[model samples]
Target: MTKNFNIWFKNFHAGIVLKVDVLIPTKDPSKIRPRLLQVLKGSDWVGEIIIETSKPLSRARVIGARKCSTEWIAMFDDDVEIPENWFDSILPFIQLKDILAISTPSIDVNNVHMIAYKRVMDHFRPLEQRDAPFIDNTLIKREVLLNYNPSPLFYSEDELLYRYIKKHGKWIHPPSCGVKHFLVMKDLVKAAIIMEQLGFYPLYKFLRSRVAYFTISILAIGYSHTYKTMTFFWKSNIKLMAGFLKARVNKKGII
Candidate 1:
């Protein structure tokens, strides 16, 4: 698979002059990190693969933008498994002048909680047309990305970049561009907590309403495969809401 990817990469990038770098910002070591590195190294289209484990995701991205020697950078999470032909799928758009950045939905159906979560997220920001781009599987131009400072929280950081990109230039979500994101219940809860802490309004604006949110939550619980998983999903949502409410009461400003 790796050899095929290299051959494909060389064939495609041979005509294109732009160099693409990859930056992975992770707070702690992850189980999937090794596989992720292996996959990235396999691609000849990718120039430098910089993994920064020291800073928060937002700061790490800034570091990557500064450190990268290429014109474009693909920012991704450590947990994401790049799909085969991922570069080939998006290379056409990269060749376009107006399309400054590109993003796609992360597909993962292994966990029931993940299914429910993705459903809600898809509802809000459909892959067909996104108001802002997601960072997990996105290709961004270094010039546009170097302008601002993103929030420390992962979700909010993505939100900040989305808005910034919208203000700067064109961003797109091509149907062909997609990646598999391995999500766990623990990480989901942690992300939700961070969203609330950083003033969840960034993502909240994309949501339909509180009513829709809870309705989908109930439907997700109903569709769970096992009682244990259902219980975990329920409790996690509760804790997430609690954190949001607490942040609201404390008068945290939403960026």
Candidate 2:
């Protein structure tokens, strides 16, 4: 468990009056958690350090945003490997006059499943010129997030929320402010189960399309020549398909 504390600091930007609060949404403490803490706590501009353990990313981010009393809220995932000067890199994008939220590119560090999964997902939901869909590493204004109050589903809630915010304001993706994402499969499996219980999948929006995902899975497996990569893709697809179908059979709406 996290011993929560609030720290105050003067706004760090030269011309901009931006006060930032970093929200870390984590369910369990892994090796990544301590590394993440080190990165986030090192920043002088980050004011509030809110650690929400054992909560969905969607719910955690929403709760964290509401608690934030700063100009910006950074809903960072706990498993990310953040670079030094992360704040400095993101500050300019967040400080943009019209940007409601800003997304940073997440580079896959070592997860083969993530690398393959990302390739498949890109076909279903491609990145927009002005916006990046994922909120795993994102910066948003307090009012914008609170006003939208995103209702996320089983998966790709970040994408849904990004589209929702895009309607009212701008979302930007800058390459300079990228973070390394480690996709742990156990966590993904748990999250998928939770999403099924919440009744958010089976709809034909975002990552709700079973056919699209399945098709990509087949393609991913067929394209890979190595045994290890093929096995990883196969197992991943089987698990996802099983969860998706189970949810669809249980519910009567939007399968």
Candidate 3:
């Protein structure tokens, strides 16, 4: 349970500005660093920029987060394009005593798998607060992450943190603070493989999320007449399920 506090969005004093440390966990910092710099240039709340190039992204995030000096840390993926006003837009959430973290939405996203996955997720959590952590562009407490430090897994580390915070308090999804994801079907597929390999993610949630997700995709294929779109959806799901099954088989030592 969180303690009650007065809303401070209106009382945002210009002189007493609170800055946030920005952490970008990516293997390709050479390419993404300048891009991130350009995107975050306009923000007043941005503090130190920590770019970690560790092999496993989760490990990189943990390293960068620990280096943060502010009360909050803004963790972003290498690929997404963040809105300039994002930090200020989510200030209301930052002021909330009950809030643990805030994940910004991926707007104007074109990827077939992401669109399909998010559409299905909408039914489950309509406020854009997903069942799994969407940490692509998120504002999180520095200490909270250090306390429940994410593992060095290639994937599903965000899920681990999500489950931990969901029990303790709220993780907000503010629609106004939007980002653009430049991810593909291949990424999710690889993530699924790594997720199974890691082996600690909740099996029930995985089964339920994937089952309902691809079921909707299959249903869409049967009913929809949009040839190009449905075909793309079909191909993406094939690779996705293939990765999952391959991971499953590998995990069971059946290969």
Query: What TM-score, computed on C-alpha atoms, does each candidate reach?
Result: 0.75, 0.68, 0.77
The candidate, 2 or 3, that scores higher on lDDT is 3
Q: Which parts of model 3 have CA positions greater than 4 angstroms off?
A: 1-11, 33-35, 108-129, 187-190, 197-215, 218-226, 252-255
lDDT of 1 at 146: 75
- 1-255 per-residue lDDT for model 1 (tens digits): 334335445765677434579988787656545766777788867898777775766778887788787777888887888776777677666655566688777776457765675566565666547554556778887877677667664556776677677777778888735577777445543555566665546655524444455555655654564455445555666666665655656654542
**Model 3: which ten-residue window has the lowest total lDDT?**
1-10
By descending TM-score, how would the candidates be arranged?
Answer: 3, 1, 2
Candidate 1 regions with alpha-carbon error over 4 angstroms: 1-18, 29-32, 95-97, 116-126, 130-132, 151-155, 176-178, 185-209, 218-233, 252-255
lDDT of 3 by residue, 1-255 (tens): 222113233235435566778998887776573556797866777788888887666667667778888877888887778777777676666556678788867753756544654555566566464454777888888877777756666556677777778788878887735677777334767777776676644678666655665566654443333445455655665666677778877776212
Regions of candidate 2 where Cα sits further than 4 Å from its true position: 1-17, 29-32, 95-97, 116-132, 150-154, 176-178, 186-225, 243-248, 253-255
Local error of candidate 3 at residue 93 (angstroms): 1.0
Model 2, 1-255: lDDT tens digits are: 111111111233234334578877676655445777887777666788877663555666677778878867887877787787777677665445567887777867777645665666666664434245757787777787777655544355676677778888888877635588876555444345545655545455425444555555556654343456655655665676666656656664323
How far residue 28's Cα lies from its native spot in candidate 1, in Å, is 3.6
Which candidate achieves the best TM-score against the true structure?
3
Candidate 3 lDDT (Cα, whole model)? 0.68
- Candidate maximizing lDDT: 3
For candidate 1, the 10 contiguous residues with the lowest summed lDDT are 204-213
